[model samples]
Every structure is written in C-alpha cells, then in structure tokens.
Target: MPDALADALYELIVATRILANEKVLDAFGHVSVRHPLDPQRYFIPRHRAPELAEISDLVELTLDSEPVRPTDFRLYSEKVIHGEIYKARPDVHAVCHHHAHAVLPYAISGQEIVPVFHLGAVMGKVQFWDQRDEFGDTNMLVVKPEEGASLARALGPHWTVLMRRHGATVAGTSLRELTFRTVFTCDNARLQSQAMAHGRVDALSPGEVKLTAAHQLRPPSTNRAWDYWVRQVEKAGLMPARAAAKGASTTAARAKKADAKRAPTKSARKNSVKSKRRR
Candidate 1:
C-alpha cells in the first residue's frame, strides 16, 4: 500500500487498540478515519471487539454512512454518529464514540464535562446532547441522520460532546489527536468526579485551556502519547500478530543500537586509556 494509505490504516488500527487498551473502548465503542484518498469516504471496522480489529475488518462507507461495497459483515447501528459529524464538520478527519463509564454520571445529569488538566484541555467547554429533548426518547441511539445532525450542532467547534444517557463523541483533525483527546477526556472525567467530592473542582479556565491545548496538539506531544499507548497494547498482546511482531522487532532494534552505543569499542578504549593517563 502507499505511504499515505498505509499510515491512515495504521493509525486507525492503532487508535482502536489504544482506546481499547486505555479502557475508553471495549466491545461497544467505535472509531473511524476519513478516507485518505477520498474525503467523501471513511473507514471503520464492522461490528467487532475493538481490540481484536484487524485491517481486513475495515469497511469503507460514504459520508451518509452507506457501505461503498456490499459486505456480509454487520455494520454498527450507530455509524450515523460518525457520518453526520463528518458531514457537518469538514475540518474533522477522525471521530470516536465511547460509552465510557467515567463520563456517564455527567452525561446522565447534563453536567458539563470540563478540562481538569492540561492533557484533557481539548475538552475546553464540552456541549451536552439530549435525545429526549429532540426526539422524545426512543432507544437513545444515533441511528438516523437527523439525530446525528442534531448532536453535531450541539458539538459546534468543540472537540467533544456528551450524549445524555448514552456516551460521548470526540472529533479531531487527525487520528492521533482524536485518540489523545478521547483517552484524556475519560481520564479528566475520572479526576473531575473525584475532586468534586471535596465540594468543588477547579477546572481549567478557558484561557488556560486554550494555551495548554495548543501545546498538547504539537506533533511531539501527540507522538509521545501514541507511542506509549501503542507499546502498552502491543506488550499486553492485545494487538494483531503483524503489529505485535513489528513492534517487537522495532523495540529489539532500538535496544541493540543503544547497547552498541553504550559498549566501549577498541577506538573508545584507546581514547579512554589516554584520558586515564592524563588524569
């Protein structure tokens, strides 16, 4: 595959595994990446355990959430969540939806999920969407275009939105950014819940959030988190065999290079002898 296509697929796969590894996704949540070759299409796996997703399971769908090609695999019922968000937000290149337990309390109560730390500062001011308010409450699933569009309107320019009695949706300019935001949002929710017990929590001010979020979006910051999470998933044997084997080889190569640098060579020993004599 071409580099661009390969990178997109790799990021999609890694993002799924990373979210599952971080506990933001289990068997329920889904992640999607806009097609690299065609903006009108996106790629997401057919319904399956996220941690076990392989490249073959990925299905390409139109912006309306219709599969580009017919397949026997069952598509996710709430895929409209990804479709309508992409339709509404052209700047968004990746989307993730998770039924994380940490954010459930705030989602159910219509409480704002604010950034409690610099990492989660992408969630500067999260908006909440209530299915009951718009659709009179059926199953609370975003299965229709109208329902998804309503949720996207609530999201506005924010990176995340809480879905009442359901879960949360996060979008990003890239898969790495989306992965980082999703994981940290869940972590922030956990922290916020714990701190709220002491009466009040000092969430980051909008100005502070803006500053910290700018720093976190830098390539170095995102790559650091991605590397860490990917390693954790690979080491735990949760990733596919090809990815795990590649990770193992990459790790071994790095270790070998480090050992070679640390061990003194004949030239280095000669230089050390001279230095010792001078001492």
Candidate 2:
C-alpha cells in the first residue's frame, strides 16, 4: 500500500502480539489506527487470536460503522464502539480496546482509571460516566450511540476511557503512542489494583498530573525504535503458527534466532532468574 498507515497498523499489531505472548492481552482485545488515506475510514483487525494477527488481517470500516468487507473477510462487532468514537471526536486517530485482567474489576465497578502509577499520574483526573443502564449488549456493552457519546464525554480531553463492565479504550495521535499508552494503562491498573488492597491509593494532584502529561513525549524516533524492535521480536521464534504464516525470510529469521540465543530469555544472571520487562 502507498499509505504508511498499514505499516503503522501492522507495527501496533506486532506490538499487540508481543503483549499477548507476554500474557497481557488474552484473545479478546483489539487495537486500531486511522487509515492514512481515508480519515473517515479506520482499520481494525478481526477479533482473532491476538498472537496470530498480521497486517493482512486488518479490515477497513466507514465512519458510520459499516465494515467494508474485503473478499472473505469478517468484521469485529466492537466496531460499533470504535466507529462512533471516530465520528464523534476528530482529534483521536488510534483507539485500543482490551480486557486486561487488572482493569476489568474496576471497569465492572464503574470506577475511574485513577492516577496510581506514574503513567496514571500523567493521565489527568479521569471521569466515570454514569450510563450503564443505557447499555444492554452484555458481550460488547458499548453499542448505543448515546452511550458512546456518554463515554466520550467522560473521556473529555483525557486519552483513556474505562468502559464500564467491558474494557478500557485508549486514543492517541499515532499507533506507537497508542500502543505504549495501552501497555502503561494496564500496568497502572495492575499496580493500582494491587495497592488498593492495602487502603485508599494516593493519586497525583491535578496540577502534578497535568505537568506530567504535558512533559510525557516519546519522540518519533522512540516510537520508530519500539515498532522496529517489536516487529523483530514478532518475526522471531515467538509463536510457531504465526511465524509459519507471515514471518521474515529464512536468513533474517536465522539471524534473529542466533541473536536471541546469544541474549538471555529469563535473565543475564543465571542464578537470579529475573524476567525482563517488555517495553
């Protein structure tokens, strides 16, 4: 494709797969990007197993929520939510929806994604919209247009939204920022979920949160580096099935394998057995 959107989308998909293989997203989450050639259209991959997605799996959708079906391709039902948001808000270009375990409990409870971790500290005071009664689709609760508007209103200027009883939604200017934000969203949730066990969690003050959010900028180079590394990892010996389907050439694969073998899987220190955190 002439547009760079596909490359960008695929990078996020690979980044997403890294999360799934790492046990962050199971099989039910999704990540999407605005079609560079078609702003009124967005690209969302089918609701397939996360680890198996590639650039080829993505389907295009209209702003009114119609999936422009390619030959033999199916659409994910949650497009109802994603499409509505794109139409309602012009600033958002990418939207990530996932059911990370750490955030589900809070989502069901209608609680806001609080500023517990430094990331959440950067996320300003989040608003929890009270519109569950309007949402009846239990499997994909964000179905109604009115409910979408409610959620968007709740998200107001914030980059993330905790969809009550369903999952969380994050919007960003580009795929990389969206990917990193999604990971951090889950990490913050995991940390905060753990902290609330003790007592009330401390949230950064509004001014502090604003300052952090303003200063948080991953340069284009940083996102580019992340995208490249994630794709390299995905093309490595990550999942046999996915690798068999659309992995790198034999020579590239061999080189990646050799590099990974040289590097440590669990830890550099043999006795400690510590895990490396995926960025």
Candidate 3:
C-alpha cells in the first residue's frame, strides 16, 4: 500500500479502537475516512465489531455506498450513513456513527445535546432527525440511499446530528477531529444529564461556544488528545500492529489484564447478593 493510504488506514484503526475503549462505540457503530486521493470514494470496515477492526478489514465504497470492487465481505447495513454525509458535505473528511449510552438518553428523549463544557463546544450545533419524519419507520436503519440523503439534509452544515431513538452521527474535517468530537460530545451528554438532575443546565453561550471551540479544536489540542488515546489503546492491547510495536509495553498490557481479573468491587458483590436474594 502507498504511504498515504497506509497511514490513513492505521490512524483509522486507532480511531476505531480509541472510540471503543472510551465507550463511545460498542459492537454496532462504525467510523470512516474519505479516500486520500479520491473524493469519490471512502473507506469503512467490513461488518464486524468496531473494537476488532484492522487494516485488512477495510472496504472502499463510493459516495453512494457501493463497493468499489466486488467482495464477499459483509458491509455495515448503515454504511450509507457515511457515504451520504460525505456526498452532502465536501468539508467533512471523516464520519462516525455511534449509539453511546451517554447520548442515547438525549436521543430517545428528544432533548438537544448542547455544549455543557469547553471541550464539547466543538459540537457547534446539533441537529435531530427522526426516521419517522420521512421514511415513516421501517426497520430504523439508514440502508437506503434516500433515507441517508434525508439524514444528510438534516445534518446540514452541522458537526453532529442525533437519530431519534437510534444514535448520533458526527462529521469532522479529519479523523482525529472526528474522534475528538464524537468522544467529547458523548461526554457532554453525560455531563448534561448530571447537571439536569441538579435542576438546570448552564450550557455555553453562543459567543462562548464559538470562541472556545475555535481555541480547543485546533491541531495542537486534537493531536495531544489523539496521542493520549493512542497510548490508552496501546495499553489495552488494541493498537494497530504497525503503531503498536513502537510504544506498546507488554508489561503494561499484562498489568491491565491482571487488573481486569481482580475480584469484584464491594458494590458489585452487594448487587450480586441482592439479586440472589430476590431470586
């Protein structure tokens, strides 16, 4: 593979694992990057868990979500989510779709996920799109081009859009930026929920959102966070092979593994006993 494509794939894999490690994506979500040399095509993983994604699992697809070449690999049913957004927004170089638990409450409750902190200001304006609005509710998947296009319209000129009762899709100018926005946006949602429990949410003002996002979303900040997340994935033993060899420590990975095997917490033990008693 060419250097550019290889690098893109490597970073894409890292972004996938980082999102999974951060709990922004579980088994169902996906992330994609536009082809480095081709505006007409983009790349996403074959149908599989996001955390398990590797370079070899990537498939190149057109803006219409068709495979560039015939393959037996199963594609994501919602691949059109990336393609249609790419087609609609030339400025968006990366796209991520996730149903993170933190964001789901807002998505299902029809509440807007506004910026509650400086980092979340990166989510400029969030839009909402209900599947029932146009498609009248089928299987709730954006499998069809028309449905994807409708979603693209709803996401018009925005950084993120929530799918009613589904998930949220985030667009960014680059892969790092997309990862940053997606992860922090979910964090913002969680913080918003906590604040709401206390009575009211003091969201950032428009001027504050604009100024802080401009300052915080720059390359230096994004790269700093990206480096930290890459190390985190490395520690979790999920970094891509090429990048993994340089910085990953077998000792640290083993230590983390050992921690996972430690006995359950007191709260967990209490919950288990309570469940048994009820049974």
Candidate 4:
C-alpha cells in the first residue's frame, strides 16, 4: 500500500494542475486535502500558482492553519479557507478555492449558481459569503481566522459557497470529488449563463439532483473525469518540464542497454591471442 500522505500530496499536485488546465484557476487559486491518516491536519501547497504547484511545494498544516514545520516558501494568505473548512466540517476531506471567471458574475450579482446539467449536481445549494457583511471594509481576502470561520458558516451543510466578489470554495469527501466539483461548477456556470440567454432557464429539480448525484459523483465516474483532465494537462505540457527530461533519460538508458546486449562479444580477441602463440 502507498503511504497515505504521499498519495495525498500526489493527488493535490494533480488537482492543482487540473484546475489550472481547466481554467478554473489562473494564478490565484489553491487546492488541498485533509491528511488521510491525520484528520487534525491538512496539506496545501505553498503560495505558488496552481499550475506551478509540485509535490515538493506542499506544506502540512494543523487544523488551525499553522505549518507543521517552518517553510521557506511563503504560505498562501487564503489558506484559512481550507483550514477553517476542515476544522468546521469533519466529513469534508478535500477543499478547493478558485476565482473562476464564469462564477464571478454570480458572486457580484447575488445570484445562486444552480446545476443546469448533470455534472453540476455536486454544487448542492450554493450559498454566498460576503466579507463586507462582517468586516465592513478590508482587502476582501480570507486572511484571518474569523473571516475564514464566517465563510465556513456560510458554507454550512453545502458543497459549495460563493465568496462575494472574490471567488468560490468547494468541499468534498475526497480529492477526485473536489476536482470534479470545481471543474463542473465552472462549466455549469458558463453553460447556465448561455442557456439563460436562449430561453427560460431550467435547472435540475431536487429530485433530479438526488437521482443523478451518485452516478456522476462517485468512484468510477470521478476517476474517469480526473484521468481525462490529467491527460489533457499532460498533453498541454503543463506538468514539470523535468518530468519529460527524466523520461527521455530513462528511454535513452534502456536503448543503450539493449544495444550493448546485442553487440558482438570480443571472442575474436582470444582467437587472436591463440594465433599469436602459435606464431
């Protein structure tokens, strides 16, 4: 069996890259996973762009959001978003925060994001969390515990919440679930807006949400979605460049080994020595 923490770190990196490839995250967003063995802590990447996040960039943090060890890489200012949600929701094992452009209009206009299609059923009952309501006026970032806690409260019992004029937070029971929710939420928003323009909008009814939720959101389906996006990301060459280099080196080494094995042995040398002795 793989180490739980190591697996979480790999998934975290892949999720970050997937979000970036899907355009759900630009340079600003982040994703995290609650440590599989240690529920009291979670793992988030240092303050790097989601596309640039690597396994080495991850930092282990307590539920309170402090690093388990000192890090030279700067921590994310909005990590409170992940930590506080983990602290508040024991059932949630993964979190994603993104400034998706398609959903920003809803954040500003006080509109609820609804599932216009099947993939979006995970967005169950989206709520809005406006920082101004409590803080009155600041940078509008969830940099403090109280602010993060307020956001968590806004997300109560829901899988998604819109942060007024900032972005959105998505939670799930696993990394694949969180990735699915984040990507589909953005896709649903774009599709919903386009659908609204054509005619009367029709979102999934509660019954529809209940019926289709499990089929689209669980293991085999979730794994397929994650795998597809990861392949796309890899195809686009968004992963670490060193990976390609390492692959090339490994292939070259294998080729060299094969050539050595196929080459003729130096049996002629012994024959020449025997011939010289005869001379």
Q: What TM-score, computed on C-alpha atoms, does each candidate reach? A: 0.85, 0.73, 0.86, 0.85
Better of 1 and 2 by lDDT: 1
Question: What are the per-residue Cα lDDT tens digits for candidate 3 across 1-279?
Answer: 335655676678889999999999997899999977668778888888999987777776778777655557778888888999999999999999999999999889999888998999998899999989898958888888798899999999998999999999999999999999998998899999999999988999999999999998999999999999989998998878854432223322332353366343333233321111000
In lDDT terms, which candidate is top? Answer: 3
Query: For candidate 4, what is the TM-score?
Result: 0.85
Tens digits of per-residue lDDT, candidate 2, 170-277, equal 777776666666666677888888888888989777787777666564565436646565765657755334453343233223333544564242232232222111
Which ten residues in a row are the worst by lDDT in model 3? 270-279
Kindly list the per-residue Cα lDDT of model 1 for residues 146-171, writing each as its tens digit.
Answer: 98899999999878999988899999
lDDT: worst 10-residue window of model 4: 270-279
| CA-lDDT, candidates in order | 0.80, 0.62, 0.83, 0.80
Report the C-alpha lDDT of model 4 over 35-112, residue by residue, as the tens digit: 786687788877878888776666666777776544466788888889899999999999999889999999988888
Superposing every Cα of model 2 onto the true structure, what RMSD results? 13.7
Candidate 4 runs further than 4 Å off: 240-279
- Once superposed on the true structure, which residue ranges of model 1 sit more than 4 Å away at CA? 243-279
lDDT of 1 at 112: 77
Candidate that beats the other on lDDT, 2 or 3, i.e. the better one: 3
Task: Tell me the lDDT of model 1 at 57.
Answer: 72
